[model samples]
Target: MNPSRPAPLTRVDGSPVRVLVVDDEANLSDLLRMALQNEGWDARTAANGQEALNLVREFAPDLVVLDIMMPGIDGMEVLRRLRSTGNDVPVLFLTAKDAVEDRIAGISAGGDDYLTKPFNLEEVVVRLRGMARRHVAAAAAAETRLRVGDLTLDEETYEVVRGGIPIKLTAKEFDLLRYLMQNQRRVLSRSQILDQVWSYDFGGTSSVVEIYISYLRKKIDSLGEALIHTVRGVGYTIKSAE
Candidate 1:
């Protein structure tokens, strides 16, 4: 018995980053599978559109390399169906047709990228890596929720909870709090806060900065140790009371 081949390399989230090569050409798929395996990535092949769909469902691919010229449920339709279902998994299309319209149609249909036929294997690999990196970055950024100890803020929902209790804030306050949490331990000057949260030049008195900071402290720090603090002459900072 021979030793089983090791699994592909994983993305930052620990699960393997799977790539699907969808092409009717067995030789090309075979070459890609071997090349991707050498890159420490999991790779699979599909001979047609229907099989590609089935594999996408089962494989939950991190990226897909699709052939535009496949017979039957062609690559364009495959992309349409995928997008219709709101599956935004990144796809790179391979096309022998160099028509500008075809590339435009593929992109407008939802393809993330495309490679003209006879593309260098190295270029294919580079494009795939670029696509995969983008997906990972988007996934990481989709983390709408930020937390520190008992305090939590949801960027998408504009909600805040601390110590298992919901806290309400005005829009300005929420924006200010979000900025503070984003910066964490970094002290921020009034001018800095005014520029970022207020998004304008106040021109003179920074009393607005002081007022909002006080408001945040009252609402956020009243029930617990201070999470927001004045840094004397420097500015202000947020950290756990401990």
Candidate 2:
């Protein structure tokens, strides 16, 4: 498998995760598409709020990357409509406006996270991964099982299965696996994982995330079917062999 594109993320029942990117800037949209694709996520793009809403109904994405400013409906209004419809898919707001009020407004409008413009792509990917992880953790209680293609994670027993075989993971490995499984197809920076999973502020080094990722790769991807990919100059993602 190519190192650039990993495998797709699947539910416990084996359904792929879908993502929607809404931005007026074509270049930014393309960048997001590339980043998400590297993670094996099925991502679609919309140039404006109206187009975003249209795709929301059709694609039913697992997550949304929404830009606040737009020609017509705007991100806040679109989020309102989504919430009105009871579609609680996580949304990460991307906008040029970086004010406390703006952040509050975005969150108040049902945004799961807020990212300012001119931000690092790694940061965006990391925040999105966190949102996805939280969403999956919530659903894990009900599902009791989580699987992506041939790999399976049992929430009840904390067991992992690959190609119908059992795999052992250390405590940290298990936590990392759970985080990766939750985020699945979204790129996660080493610093971001350290912050979320480690529950501490990360210093200026990525050695920890890299080391654990290496450990995970040995156990999860040593069999030729690569599930973890490194995005050069960015971060890593847990995706299926693509």
How do the predictions measure up, each by TM-score?
Answer: 0.59, 0.56
lDDT of 2 by residue, 111-210 (tens): 9999999989988877777776677666657686767668889888999998877889998898888888888888887767887778685555548788
Expressed as tens digits, the lDDT of each residue in 7-70 for candidate 1 is 4446767766789999999999889888887777889999999999999999989999999898
Candidate 1: regions farther than 4 A off? 1-9, 144-242
Give per-candidate clash totals: 0, 4
Q: What is the lDDT of residue 28 in candidate 1?
A: 92
**Model 1 lDDT on a 0 to 1 scale:** 0.88
Candidate maximizing lDDT: 1
TM-score of 2: 0.56
lDDT of 2: 0.84
Clashes of 2: 4
